[model samples]
Target: MAEANHGKWTYCVDLAREEGRRRTRRRGGFATRAEAAREMKAVLDGELRGVYEDRRTTVASYLREWLAAAKERLAPNTYAGYADCVERDLIPAFGHHRLPDLRPKHIDCWVAAQQDAGRGRVTIYRVVSTLRNALNAAVRSWRLRYNPAKHSVPPKPRAAERTCWTPDEAAAFLRHNAEHYADRLTDLFEVMLGTGMRRGEVLALHWSDVHLMDRKLYVRWTLAAVNNNESLFREPKTEASRAWISLSPRVMAALHRQAALQVAAHPDGRLEGLVFAKPDGLPLRPQWVLDQLRKRTAELGLPKIGLHDLRHTAASIMIAMGIPIAVVSKTLRHTTLAITINLYGHLLKDSADEAVKALAAALDRADAERGASESPLPLAA
Candidate 1:
């Protein structure tokens, strides 16, 4: 060990391989001789345990490498999100630091800076989570001893309240659609609101999957947009999302109308094409759909909502009609019942109140009957 020109301590070690080949490892930038000695000993111990890691890797390099590998495993949309956070956020903030030199304080300061910069809490949370995930991969690969971002991650932001329309509002919106803009989206919105299918699931629906005679449709695929440009047909969001859904009468009618339009447009009967598509049979752009929805809702003087809100509106309607929560969960195809409950619990308040009222009425009637029976026996005596 020796002092460097930069006024920091440096150390070197030599090792022999099983084949008698020799290798040298050097490290520097320790502030004191004692610190250098401690690091050298730790390195030697790591080498003995066969867990040695190169300390020269920088955050930017490792993060990029991790992202490249992640692309193959993650869904296109998910990978796009991760790539955005890594390139636009993580790289700029922590890129210059050596991977091994990163500490919790560095992450803490960066998070503080982000907060001070007026960034949204959700964006900050996602970016920090990306860092933590990348560092976790490094630790698993033996490139990191511990993840500095592990405990420094910000609390997840609360989900925004969903804007849902009531049944009357939904009907009015549909009526407006039929009167002013009777197009493919009219039937699309009808199907979405009637059956509680996700926007992606409905867009990716193929005519072959629809059993109109049986009033059911299979959800096998979902159309995912990557970077708001390219669309890819991926599997359903979850295994439960791929199951068959029973269609309502109105939804079946909408499908029948859509089929008639498609059949009239394509004399060849494009049964294998998407159930909801453009005149050329290509999938409709999600953003374009949102823009149209906004325009129509504004014209009808309804609350501004997105395509996903149609799904929420369906769920709220079902809950209001006294559908069982489990059935609602199945209809929504949530991965877990808890997810359904967490999302729609607020809507169940009326049902809960009604349930307790019925229970109280039953108990009161039983108590009255018992009191009359005891008093009648005394009167007869």
Candidate 2:
């Protein structure tokens, strides 16, 4: 029913209850009676369809509820990221607004404000993504009609180009490590560059997973840091990342050296501990490894590259050696071939040119053969 009260229209309707109890839902402040009636009809329709959303739920409450549910299902690192964005950014921005009252315009204004505040594009993108994801969940649960943040999210930031070493540069760096900084890190760097293993995967490696005689190792765990404060061992990044990786001779050599060093450091240590650990037998911090890499690169007067760049450098070297992209993808343990292509497509330019040239040569030979076969033999007689 719709009524006029104080120059505004109001609508009231009884809500369907599962139990034998009557409940009423009412709304006011529409400019016209028709608008109020339409809204009432829509609410009735939604209730009939079992998708009625309560407008009383604030964004703050909904997000908090959603986060609590998300924590049980999401990975620790992933949940930490979501929690940080929701509590530090999203809730602070629009927590007062009702979930049902959220509009695309509101999301757009927030994105613009973030941009004006000189926030990093990647940071803004991630926070908006968190909002969009939470709102998507609300839409799926019928808590909201639609996700207002869906179309209003900022564009994802492009990955920055990574600096990778050439074969000579890599060789020179390894040699320098061997001569000057000959320690466990020397072997660690050798294993990283040789196998293209991720920092976490390498750090989480266990001696039991390595087979020196067979020249292979299994990737089972990855060490993840939560908020850069605490470390935890988690499953591999993907199922493919858990598969066996064939070790190169250089990698095998590094492992042997690491084994010797481990024996000298801890004669009574068990074999079940981490392959790469500090003196206290705890996993080495990823940040500390990066810091050492920076310090060494600066000392060597080489272009500064992060530890992850060693993985890229390995992929580049393999691609340059005419290795098949599929093989390279498998070697790198990429979940998909497209990922390898996307990351190293620029390096495939020469290979692509060679393929086209070979095709052109074959076509030219076919054309010449066809012309010779069609020529008249009488001229030669």
Candidate 3:
């Protein structure tokens, strides 16, 4: 053990292996030797648990290494997102800080700084999530003693008041499209508003997946934009999402029309591979859908909503019609009922109110029936 004076007695523990193989830890610049000893004690205690890291590793270096290792196993989109968080947000904010020295307060301060820089809670949530996940991997691999980010509270995403078209509004939008802009994409919107399929899921729809005769559709895959403007076809969001869902009558009718359109467009009489393709049989871009919807709705004086809001419209329509939440969960193919509840449970407000009213009405009716029956029995006796 060696003690040096750098404004105070800074100490180094000589955890030397026999035969002069040296393993040492140094901590410094404390007001008291006792303070240094306390930190030294903590480090010694942690060493027993295989929790010691080379104290020289900075947050930036560790995150870069984590990203390099993780990118191989991650999905293209996921890897891209983590890279952005590490390079653009996390490393910039915390690069110089030692990885193992991070604390909950440091993470909290970073979040506040993010807010000051005009990042939303959702964005902050994602960035912090990336940091936490990286550190978690570090801890498991013995690069980090513990994840201080685990104790940190990232900003909670305020569930923005989800604005969506009502059934009436959706019907009007469809009618407007059919009346004025009866294109291939019109059927796309029709299917989305009816089946509650996501924009990517709908865009990736294949004729093979659509069972017109059975009034069902299979959500086999989805499309994603990754690696600049390039697009990739990927699996459904979750295993639960890869499911077969029933089609409504309107959706089935739209499919029949889409088949006719596809057949007439090509010399081959058969409805081809993609149910919704461009005139030249190219896959329609999601940006085209977004732009068209925005443009058309603006012309028609309808409230502006994205393709995703059409999905919310479908769920809202089902909820308004008194469909069971469990059925909605299955239709949407949420990984769990809790996930379904968390996202769309607010829409069930009317259902809850209706349930309470029904219970009260039943009780009242039962009391009246009992009163009448008791008096009649007395008269009969």
The candidate scoring highest on lDDT is 1
Looking at candidate 3, what is the lDDT of residue 196? 91
Better model by lDDT: candidate 2 vs candidate 3: 2
RMSD of each: 4.7, 5.1, 6.2
TM-score for candidate 3? 0.80
Model 1 lDDT at residue 273:
93
lDDT of candidate 2 over 1-381, digit per residue (tens): 334356888888999875889989889877788878777887898888767666557999999999999987787889999999999998988999978788999889988988999989999999999999999998898777778998988778989999999999899889999999888899999999999999999999999999888999999999998876799998986898998989888888889888887876776754658889998889998899999988888887888999889999999999999999999999999999999999999999999999999999999999999998896667654
lDDT, residue 174, model 3: 92
> What clash pairs does model 2 have?
none
Q: Which ranges of candidate 3 are over 4 A from the true structure? A: 1-47, 267-270, 372-381
What does candidate 1 score on TM?
Answer: 0.87
Candidate 3 lDDT by residue in tens digits, 1-381: 234544575667766466878788676666777766766776776667766665557999999999999877787889999999899988878888988788889889988887898977888899899999999998998777778898675657777767888777788889999999888878899999888999889888999998888898899978786753667778886799899989888899899999998888778687768888778776688888899999888877888898888888888888889999999888888899998788888899989999999999999999999888875545565
Report lDDT (Cα) of residue 153, candidate 1: 91
Residue 15, model 3: lDDT of 68
- Candidate numbers sorted by lDDT from highest down: 1, 2, 3
Q: Rate the local accuracy (lDDT) of all candidates.
A: 0.89, 0.89, 0.83
